[model samples]
Target: MSNHQNPTHSIELTREATNRYVARNAAGVEVTFGRGEDLMSPVELLLAAIAGCSSIDVDTVTSRSSEPTEFKVEASGNKIAEENGGSHLEDLNLSFNLSFPDDEGGRKAAGLVDRLVKLSHDKYCTVSRTVEHGTPVAFETEISVGREEDGNKDTE
Candidate 1:
């Protein structure tokens, strides 16, 4: 059997306060976070990571597929405290709406979405797997076609 492994990656953070901190990567992307008076405390950054990962994955996969496509992704989650003390997200959802030409191509697009999500979550997206161990993740996709001039898509 061929042995393959995903590269291990890490993020470093510096604590700022009881509920605030800053995170950055070697490439210099920085993110500042705080509790913001919410029940979830501070792991919202992880949710954003999952969302961003899936979004990029979907867009890339669709664009490289049999048809030209454009899309957007939105991800959200509910956080609940675990019995042991730490909080965990309860329900995480990701929604993808894509636009492409032709109904036949759209159908193929749907199948491609399944493969994309699996590849992202299972093989590539560390954020998704990490969150999944703590909570349930769900995803949905909608396919459409054509673009309009007003900075918005006109779906049929």
Candidate 2:
């Protein structure tokens, strides 16, 4: 077998109520999401992950020269449903608007913006690359039935 190794990234979600959940990462940081009210939906989280991955790529490269005065990235897509009951996002897009101060370091950083953004989307961003390459996702079921007492926690 080859000696190549890949790091694993994972998050676990626990349901709070009927439609609400809390997602926790390995570091224990948590984010609450759900279906009711103004909470972000799963689709929104996917969009954010794409934009966030690209943002990290661009910032890592650009900040080597100078810090950005402003950095904003927006991910957008049309959620569409097929006749077969499957739904997916269409026309997905990520837009970046970054600015640097008016000076040499800033100019140098600004000069790298376009290339950095392109490189991020085409190469560096794991999230976007995984989507663009159509990576296969395998699903397995490991459900445990809780009995007797206070609705024993599930969702993980």
The best candidate in terms of lDDT: 2
lDDT of 1 by residue, 1-156 (tens): 885767756566777787777777878786778786643335566676888888777766676645645666677788788899997566788786666777776677667887788788787776687666664546666555675557576665
Off by over 4 Å in 2: 1-3, 148-156
User: After TM-score superposition, what is the CA distance of residue 40 in candidate 2 from its true location, in Å?
Assistant: 0.9
Supply candidate 2's per-residue lDDT for 99.
93
Per-candidate Cα RMSD to the true structure, in Å, reads 17.7, 3.6
Q: What is the lDDT of residue 88 in candidate 1?
A: 59
Single out the weakest 10-residue window by summed lDDT for candidate 1. Answer: 37-46
Write down the lDDT that model 2 would get: 0.90
